[model samples]
Target: MAVQPVWHFNRSALAAIALSTLQSGLAQAITLMAPRQMGKSEFLQYDLLPHAEEHGWRVRYFGCATVSPRALTRRLQEALSDFAAGEKWLMRQFARLAGQHAATARAAFPERLVQELAQLRNEKKPSLLVIDDVDRVLQLAGGDTLLREILRAFAGTNGQARLVLSSTLTGHHQGLPALLQQQTTVLTLPDIGDAFVHHLVGQYHQLTRTKREDDNPFGKLSPYQGITWGQVDEGIMQDAFNRLQRIPYYFRALVEDLVLNPERAPAEALQVQLARLQRHRVAVLSWEEMSRLDRLLLTEVAKGTRQFYGDTLRQYLAAQTGAARVSTSQVQSSLKKLMRNRVLGQEADGRYLIIDPHLAAALSVTDKA
Candidate 1:
């Protein structure tokens, strides 16, 4: 199989390795969390799923953000039914039964899936189910209950079926039932580091030195046209590492900008592109996605009111909203949510700081408005 080209391997590869190693352990579920645009989805699609399939594990991927619970359940049942039947004749037989007893299929799909999974185990086969954007699933009505039941059905598979849940580090995960949470091993993707940056720059340089052909892996661009590897000095690479903050998305953008503006030096081109990206990220990327209360709390932190007790925030909120009073519990709850989302970091002294400085600048603008 032809594998897709990936930019550079990061810590997410380590997380995938850990998941593979722990397959025989007590933990049956792994929860992976990363910030937006951090390549979590691509890592699972191009790397993890292929690895699992190579080891003879049947893989079912659920894009949780795009499907409802009913639709998800139906799709899962169809896939498992296909797996259980194997032959075309057997699949036709299962399809006939599904059409004849639609109501029964609705009620018994979970049980049937469990049975089929057991059959796979008997045949010395195992399965893996990956649900991406699991946080979106938890936000739906009765989603927690539905997820709990689905996981419960898989419990009897005795390690035949492994579950991997991927999502941004949103507060919605707090809604997961205790049983599910306890069984899950949480893996967080750290921010891009210097090593990956160095590796990526090296990869680009190698691609440039290779003969430019129609089948050039790095794309059709002539090496002579733009800021080739030769033009990017050590100082320029270090400047990119610092200015792009080593984030993959930002790094890619900077590289593209340099390619487009080859006349400019790498460091100068990167500075221009980085400023543009930072502005877009602060105004359009991060701030627009935050909740109202989260935005407010972050704005307060950006304004130098770092330490916020429950009562302190409640009073501040009351004054800002023109409400007669606000509850301390509400303030505390928002703080916890913001912390989970990684928008705010709490120190040992209980003071909170806006985790991203660019976001702080955006919040300050909003505060003044």
Candidate 2:
């Protein structure tokens, strides 16, 4: 089957809102919070970056979740050099018009690379930095110190530069919100909406369209052969989107399956995707990392345990771990680990919720067993 082009749902308005919030001086940095595979990365690259540039702001993007401190620092320095060199033309014009000499211009630059990069922006042109998976970076050894340095760099008086950080629930569990409450604005990326579903339906229909002379009326027969693509429309697409929990990645996967295998119903494709997700490498690795107590906590959270440190849960943990006793601190520590790993999130009501849908589905199977 031929590969279909990527379908993008325009989110310029959301990008505008975020940029406006930054321009209004409400916050120096904005952290967009969402679950994994919900299209945060795509939005940053396709939507936010372009909008910032169109508005005359220089934009730099970095995904530093898995990199070492030295590597991350190197990448940032490279970005700084590239952007600074690109803007040197403008700086030169300013120097000529102001009649400033080379020595004074060089001396005016900030000591740090990041701060120097920020100095490139002025009232007419600002800079925006989009950093993804900031939660993981903050959890790295000495990560907190590095992050504080970056924050301080942006805080300088040199022309304004805005920071946009992205994180999952793990960041919240690790106290990201409270830690940066005074300086950061938190935004939730909304789910894929009706427009996206509508687009998928249209694309599927276009792909499945058959020629009149074809022996097979639908041009090709799908393996499942239970439903024809003719039956798919916006309503069916909306149903599939909801069933997939409005996760863009899974929904797109289901549509791709239908495009490749036209006989499969949307419902069947959804089931296939969910099954595949249950065995996903990340999910499997996370499950392996859990201790016995951590596994119990996961199942208990799936069962809606609000009082994780209570006597009943402590007794259960003690019995399960075969220990003489389980202290409240011990249970608390386990829960914190789960949160840090992005397995669970706590609500304002003190209820624990599974942050990963794949893990939650796996837990549901365990519940039935």
For residues 44-119, could you state the per-residue lDDT of candidate 1 as single tens digits?
7666777777778767676766676667655545644555544342654566676866676667766765666566
User: Could you tell me which 10 consecutive residues in candidate 2 have the lowest summed lDDT?
Assistant: 169-178
Candidate 1 versus the native: TM-score? 0.66
Q: Score candidate 2 by lDDT.
A: 0.70
Check candidate 1 and list the clashing pairs: none
Give the Å error, residue 75, model 1. Answer: 4.0
Task: Write down the RMSD of all candidates, one decimal each.
Answer: 7.1, 7.1
Error of 2 at 61 (Å): 1.8
Using lDDT as the measure, which candidate wins?
2
TM-scores of the candidates in the order shown: 0.66, 0.71
> What lDDT score goes with residue 281 in model 2?
19
